[model samples]
Target: MNVAPVTPPRPLDVAAVFPQLVPLARTATRLHPRPGAPTWYDSSIGGPLLWPADEPWPHCEGPHEVDGMNPVLSPADVRLERRIRAASHGREMTPQEQKTLERIRPPRKLPMRPAVQPYDGSMAMLPVAQLYARDVPDLRAPKGTDLLQVLWCPFDHPIMPRTALFWRSAATVTDILGTPPEPPAMQFDAYLPEPCLLHPEQITEYPDHLELSTELQEQLSQWSVPQADEEDMDPQTYYDCVLSNAPGWKVGGWAAWDSTDPCPRPCPECGTGMEVLLTIATFEEGDDEGRSWSPYENPAAEPSPGSDHFDPGRPTAVQIGRGHRQHLYICPAAPEHPHLELMT
Candidate 1:
């Protein structure tokens, strides 16, 4: 079993400092996804899914953005390049390796694969995550469903890969797909997520001030910073970054609203307010690894050998829109309702 760290106490008692904010508290499950071999049975990020063999694999019929410049590269091509890129760290790339990269840079006619169930032009979606309700504490599902599988078209749906959601009963998936189909070509390398097992940690959170009412926002802005050293800094900034949202992959939490101001994200099927189902994050924590939302680990424990030396916060190797987050929002009233997607 993979070892998961425990999140230490918050820098200050937010509730005690601001009693009125008590009602705003929401529980979020921080899915600390780390590099590991996760099977279909596991709740994981970028791991092989528990997809049924008989059912057709999901594909994004993107009305996809076609920028005539960069050639769409196959999943294998991107994976090969990532491997080379990772190996080249701390050392110069070999002449052959450099040449290989240069060759793949240009657009070339990709050979078609043997028809897998007579494929149409729609690109095969990449597996983004698979969450078993048992593993993720906050993953509520529709009736008779306990598993959630997420997939995304490897091409950009404007800014990021468009996601599709599926929820099913684990017991019903008798014949699991041994190998799933891959997109013939993907637009960006970051769209593909490296397999990582999850360590879901539940924590309480409040909404970013941007999501609060005007009166509350004004009140929060005037409140004093709880930390003595941070007194000079803006109180709203301190609360938003430190006291509010817990970073990394999480479920059922408030939106940070960092990229754009908070906006209406109502479910299309039924105009109900949507709830955060899953948050696919870029970095695990804030500026200081040991501070803010980062977990506190045993100081004497030695670093494990053979761990991927990629971005420490990015064990999954998935970078969303220049190190931001992508959230999947489901209807709280009816989870089966069409979900909402946002990048922040």
Candidate 2:
């Protein structure tokens, strides 16, 4: 019989963990702020928040669905709808007009979940959550209308949960506004504000203001600086850029296509299935690594050492924007097929 070996206790650093625990700890430490803590009132009408003068507004960088609907439901459409209604001159809507408006009414009920099968192809008796959203009129009528109502079920997957929630929410607005639906877009840094969890008495406002999480606030702060675009900036520094803005993970756009598969036909320019060649992903200063630097709008000027280069080949250095991107790499072998067909 062997005796059990003793295990050493692991060391913990309270100091290192302090920063991570502070925000939540602060919220729990105080039962509540005094009657007048800091009241943040949103009165931007229907427009975007003015954003703090010292801070930059966050731009969507992650994968997201771009709508392809004609007569698309957009912020601008909200204005057009009002104009059309105003031009009617107080005349009551005809049956056709009534139907038109009714068709645009947002969804109210939660969507049904598909039946799932266990080992025997039957769903477990677990509860499922459904999500829904709708639209409402603006108080001032024209500045903006409230994109009303969103519901989320508890059963939703946590990974990329916001994508589904946001899509369902936006879809309701799109349907009621007579907008054709677009596939969902997913981006790394983009996010919807977290909903407030409060009792009816605790919250006076019927509609709560969307609050960005402290972590998200910090991310937006980092992304806001114009200097971050500098070529000298670390390539890894912009890794968030690729995560937030590139289109491959979802669908659509040139980035969505898969170049690795063998092409059925030859390339468009060379009449051969274009081979995937390793090229340097280089950043030029002032957006002009190749062309003569323009005086009108020079965004960047020199390549920074912080930039990381990805090479399928063993090349340490290569020219960017030369034959690397379009002619040698991006073209299709077959004339019949679109070069940039997105891989699902």
Candidate 3:
């Protein structure tokens, strides 16, 4: 895929507006992943990784709850349903038409047991995403590691899917695993991420309003006090454009603490502080303010529903509770140490 450089929106000079905030500016890289089938060499979601064939594949052993009524339909069945809906085009369905469609495409019946049964005596893990430092410039791996592979069980574990992170050197994997096992059924379509190629664009970012101190926040809200050439400029609009954090899937940006306060995440192996490595966001922007982070080129093009560009926020189609975000944290001191996940 031809990756174009992002054309960032022209933001108000906040530092010029308020000199006190000059030191708060930070750079972040947005990994804009579009739908595609990526190879082992490409940085992508639901793509193959450079895994050694000798190593054991990761799997989750769980007693997951089964939804017997909700069945996993085959790809063919899904396509047929789509064709039927398209043909109908919202027109009322006649009894004969409905009966014929029902007979051809019956309601799906999902398995009563978990997607992958524990003690099945096999490594039944499914690949989620794979990233190479060469492809994703913002990936922070250990000195010897350049590859990051993420996998998870198809079934949910409590509130979210159970995930595992593996960091390795691409050169060390001489014997690669050509094929891997997949779960019999996935609980949700969102869980199945479509393959997407990354177009990493570096941009400036700032702390979310929630991260700022009460006093500093109050100072920002008092836009009326500041003398400006544009009398129509709203203080709140300026704050949203220049002061707030840019949204979307990014690296090395401040956490979005809109729902809750910042909770200190410490490494389990070492008590050292863990930093945010990657943010798996549901939508590129939660609100209008997030539009500041939209790609520079064609920023105003609105994608229609069901189009490839539809749901600009969820390019990867990976959702965590109605379009919330999942933050992946790694130990700064020991990059190889186990990572942690927080869904917010």
Can you give the TM-score per candidate against the true fold? 0.87, 0.18, 0.77
Please give the CA lDDT of all the candidate structures: 0.78, 0.22, 0.66
Give lDDT tens digits, candidate 3, residues 216-329: 788777863352224345555456544456666777666776456677789999989887777777776535443545665533244323423234556676777677777788
TM-score, candidate 3, is 0.77
**Root-mean-square deviation of candidate 3:** 5.6
| Candidate that beats the other on lDDT, 2 or 3, i.e. the better one | 3
lDDT (tens digit, per residue) of candidate 1 on 234-291: 5547777777888888988887777887788888998998889989888887643235
Best by TM-score: 1
Query: Who is ahead in TM-score, 2 or 3?
Result: 3
Clashes of 1: 0
lDDT of 2 by residue, 9-63 (tens): 1122221333432332210000010011111121111112212234322222222
